[model samples]
Target: MNDAVHSIAAKSAAPLPKSAGVTGRTNDPARTMAEILKVATHEFADKGLAGARIDEIAAATRTSKRMIYYYFGSKEGLYIAVLEESYRRVRSIESELNLENLPPEEALRTLVGFTFDHHNGNQDYVRLVMSENMLRGQYIAQSKSIQALNVPAIRSIRDLYDRGVVEGVFRPGVDPIDIHANISALTFFNVSNQYTFSQIFKHQMQDPQVLAQRRANVIDVLVRYLRA
Candidate 1:
């Protein structure tokens, strides 16, 4: 080719500035992903998988659809990612509670209370869980690492229960998984059923006094059940 043609082609073919690219590259990819996940969490929780829109999430995060897809591959991929992050966040906080340092009964109570507070305060997490259940957990089942995130929770309970058994405070033969399940059920109900239960029963579940009483009642119920 002639010099003029070669020069023109080179100019035309040269890479665009990173700023000019469609990828929407960020200096802080981790922060960008976190932001996207944060917005997507609400989107999925509020709309579920079938109803959530990537464009809306991107708009909310000041990101592009391409960037979200670049990071998470697809809408379902992002949903799965949000689920992982939700579970990871809860499990991360649960791990940091340091329940092992407390006595078994106290540990159980603390764990239950924390779960209650977490579910109550972070209703989005509960909503995401409920949304997933509505799909029979098909998306959560796609997550390879989510189950791993929850293992430490059960292990923590197991350690505390073993200590309680040794100290003769908690009865023996109870499965740690069952204890975890019971605690989860008791705490989960407070958030999951609050609106419906409150409406049906004609009571204010969000009342501070009522909440305090319910929290104490749940803790008492579990503690009494495990006492030797």
Candidate 2:
């Protein structure tokens, strides 16, 4: 995404051979990649794609730069990989929610609460999302699997809403995508605008009490809107 890192891909001479070094290189390649991603995620989220350095990530991961490239293909490739992993992680956890077993209203509330907790606890996800938007979503656009990764989120809403309507618990004719947009908007704003909003409004949005109230409000707002 950054012009400076654009050519880093072409500079990759070749794959790196495994070596015994603290470069985070080890006999286990998967573990090495995971270590790299863990460090790189913070680096990229903190500094963004343009400012993030492979050398810094390499140092942090104790893995060679060549090793990083060998796994991801390029800096951009690694960045995309990071984005994909972030989305995949949240979605993967969401799928295990097993909302189908709960009543529609409780399921919706649980989902909203979980979404809020996730956005609050995983500020990295929100920051990465904010960083991506600042780039006008160009890097994320390069990612082919991102869209597919998010499909289940909307599908989950659709399934719940359909069941609710059939049971006469939720109102009919609500678009699942619209419901999803509302849910995300409500939860996402808490983390994305925390600092600026706090400074501007003198409200400590991150305070546990405040967050608890906001969390309740988010769940109530959606439940009220969806219920028959």
Candidate 3:
């Protein structure tokens, strides 16, 4: 991985306390918002939209359902907030790669490696995202913030594709959006469905060595396909 990607992975993997006050007071609005989001993420991941409960989130966060409503407006609003926040965090990490500065192949490798590491490390986030998509993204699209966060990343990938074509590293016919979807599907599907994947494959999918090999294979395939 490149230095930027490595830096982000390191920061994400670093251990964090269960609760940290963003505003230096447990009940401060910012701190409370953070706590509520953390709890909501876990709740949504463990239980799909149909299964998640605001009351459980309130109790887990040591806050009230009224406070959650006051802060996020509604259950759908809270779900959107969690989705937006999750996307923001992932996008922030992705932005650090600066693929514009690297050669085409190296840039592709960096992106694939970063994506694989991210999903592998944050399985719960992956589950929550997949669960949302399973519901056809009705909730996510309602969040203007989530919609807005996607433009920069999409533009960045297009810029990279342009660069690769100019350098004769990738075929001129490739669509940037297609490339993005391919990468996302490859990295996300297996991890998001690890339990079923393991059952089908008849092995423990959580083995560290197996995951490392999977990441390597994903990068190799993506790089070869782009270079071809």
Per-prediction count of colliding residue pairs?
Answer: 0, 3, 0
> lDDT per residue, candidate 1, 1-228, as tens digits?
123322322333444335423455445666777898999999998998999999999888877886666667678888888898899999999988899899888999999999999999999999999999999989877777789889999899999999999999999999999999999899899888999999999988889999999999999999999999
Q: After TM-score superposition, what is the CA distance of residue 112 in candidate 2 from its true location, in Å?
A: 0.5
Per residue, candidate 3 scores C-alpha lDDT tens digits across 65-160 of 766666676777777778878999999999999888998888888998898888888887898888987999887766666777878878888888
lDDT of 2 by residue, 149-216 (tens): 99999989999999999999999999999999999999999999899999999999999999999999
lDDT score of residue 140 within candidate 3: 77
Off by over 4 Å in 2: 1-25
TM-score of 3: 0.85
Error of 2 at 32 (Å): 0.7
* Least accurate 10 contiguous residues by lDDT in model 2: 3-12
Show the lowest summed lDDT stretch of 10 residues, model 1.
1-10
Q: Rank the candidates by TM-score, best first.
A: 2, 1, 3
Candidate 3 Cα lDDT to native: 0.78
Better of 1 and 3 by TM-score: 1
Each model's lDDT comes to 0.84, 0.86, 0.78
Ranking 2 against 3 by lDDT, winner:
2
Name the weakest run of 10 consecutive residues (lDDT summed) in model 3: 1-10
Comparing 2 with 3 on TM-score, the higher-scoring candidate is 2
Alpha-carbon TM-score of each model against the true structure: 0.89, 0.90, 0.85
